[model samples]
Target: MPEEKQQTPPGSETEMNVKPDHGEQSYVGHGRLQGKATLITGADSGIGRAVALAFAREGADVLISYLNEHEDARETERLVREAGRKAVLVAGDLADPAHCRSLVDQAVQAFGKLDVVVNNAAFQMSHESIEDIPDEEWNRTFAVNISAMFHICKAAVKHMKPGGSIINTSSVNSDKPSPQLLAYATTKGAIANFSAGLAQSLAEKGIRVNSVAPGPIWTPLIPATLPPEKVATFGQETPMKRPGQPAELAPVYVLLASDEASYISGARYAVTGGTPIL
Candidate 1:
């Protein structure tokens, strides 16, 4: 039998047909993020959706800015509301600077204040070598992955008060390079340095900036971006021998966004399933 075709680009959780085990049924919160207003890009699915639901469960109203996955975005909103918190879905391309600015504006307008900004949206196309990567693809990757973060941070900081948190979704690739993801890895590395620089600049304002570098987790992006054979062995190459679940990374977002992490800034948290990043 032939293998089923996978969905591509900004993949949808709803169209996934088989529900991803988001651990929604098992995830519990103790109000670590209560009463906060958070803006999370790419919250329509994957790690973003997990973080959105986790934030909501902890009593934070979330604004999810995604590409164009309406079904996944709606499901995220529904689950957030079920957790007894408000969720707003804003769909647009983050590669545009104007749209990046609007994402911050809309979040603040809806929630009255933006306490946390999670720059989580990103795209990657595998290429065997630098020569194989099209110029357009390289530019698009950087625009969405790095440039949008700059735009959102600049806009979000205007509305954010002291104690604000900025969490960028970096990847383990930032430190460990996979030849196939050269351009994508470059962006992640840039994110790490960007987060560090921003942290220093924002320290005087009491705003903490940091990043979470995930190794591999089961999300729609896996099937959409990787070959089927590669997808089957997704996290097996990792020391853990299995891909992580989204829920596994949600708590890190909670800790970083809350006052509990007030003194933590300019740090990169490695949630890479035992992959050492020294």
Candidate 2:
């Protein structure tokens, strides 16, 4: 099969040539997350949206934070509400430190307590050369990708109780840095380290911190960030020879956010569809 590609800025799944599947009907929860309150950044689409649906179906209310993707965010909220769980949508730029902290406050205000936090929102752009990468872009990437995590976690941890969980979204680029995504890759590496280090720091409080490293998943970010040519063969370099659907990543997130992983902290679980992260 030949690779087909399409592009949309601030990526929209509806506009994507290959619409990303986010476990809409395939996921069935067994009450693993019953009665939990969660705050998920990037919950408007892709992995974040999938996680929100999975969590809600498993008996959790989710606070979804996204950046000006209202239509998509509303859909996510509808799905969560349909599952009989509360869903609150907070739209703003995560690159702003004040917005990051305010979101944590919004979630606590909505749900009264924060049981889970998924720092999954991120930004990236493909550059042919480092010289082409503007300094402002690099700083923006770091601010949104890693710096926002620090602010959100710092604020949310205060409202987190014993047994709370924090999940960060790293990427396959963290281990296998892509020359084209130099800035984004560097931030991913930082995420992996931050998740592990924060895990140990929070261990005494009965809280857990972990990271999920996904390979080329069929999400809007691919088309939105990568060029059309690169997007065509986006995940073909991996042994899987294809991209993973967003739905496939939900189970791992559910496990990490649940009490089932009580002993699983400071670890980076890779769903690379056969790419070795080590």
Candidate 3:
């Protein structure tokens, strides 16, 4: 596989070495999320987009949030609409606290209520040395990865009722920190802790909070954030020796969002192909 390192930060899916597989044709929903309303960040592509498709197929209306991937976001909306569910697209930088709050408000305004929130948007970059990482880059990573989740969750909990669910996107890096991904790995650890603590705190409200720790998945974020050399061999180090597709994660997300997970909270679910998170 060949990869062209992206010149811009947070690379676009359209310019990827290999565009991610979002399960447009394969994912089948079993009405697990019937009549539910969901808000998913990063729903323009990758795991978030796949989750939106599955949720809609399972009979949930989705409100998608993305930075500025209008074309990709529109395709996600089309998939949701094709499933006979409502799709609302909101574009902005979630790194901003006000924008994070606005996403919650938009979801509430569009759906009237929120049943599920998937904080799946994130930012990452690879650097050889700490000296190579800038102060603003470190802050931006935290702001988009963990702080945005905190801000959005704070605003979203108010509109959610009993049996609502919140799923945060963590990473296998949390268990095995990658020195090259210091900032991203750190934020993932925080996300896991946040989910566990919030789950306990929200027990009275009956809102289940959990995190999904994924290994190397073939998403646009990979090529965009990594050096060209690393991108070409991405995920080859994993036991599976291949990156898991975005569609492969949709089922786990669907299960977490469904009421069937009523008793499953405060847990970190690892979807790292052949890697063990513990």
For each candidate, what TM-score against the reference? 0.96, 0.97, 0.98
Better of 1 and 2 by TM-score: 2
Q: Which stretches of candidate 3 lie over 4 Å from their true place?
A: 4-7
Candidate 1 residue 277 C-alpha distance from true site, Å = 0.9
How many backbone collisions does model 3 have? 0
Model 2 stretches astray by more than 4 angstroms = 1-8
Best candidate, lDDT-wise? Answer: 3
Q: After superposition, how far is residue 205 of candidate 1 from its true place, in Å?
A: 0.3
Find the 10 residues in a row with the least total lDDT in model 3.
Answer: 2-11
Query: Candidates' lDDT values, in order?
Result: 0.89, 0.91, 0.92
Worst 10 residues of 2 by lDDT: 1-10
Q: Which residue pairs of candidate 3 clash?
A: none
- As a whole number from 0 to 100, the lDDT of residue 278 in candidate 2 is 84
Q: How would the candidate models be sorted by lDDT, starting from the highest?
A: 3, 2, 1
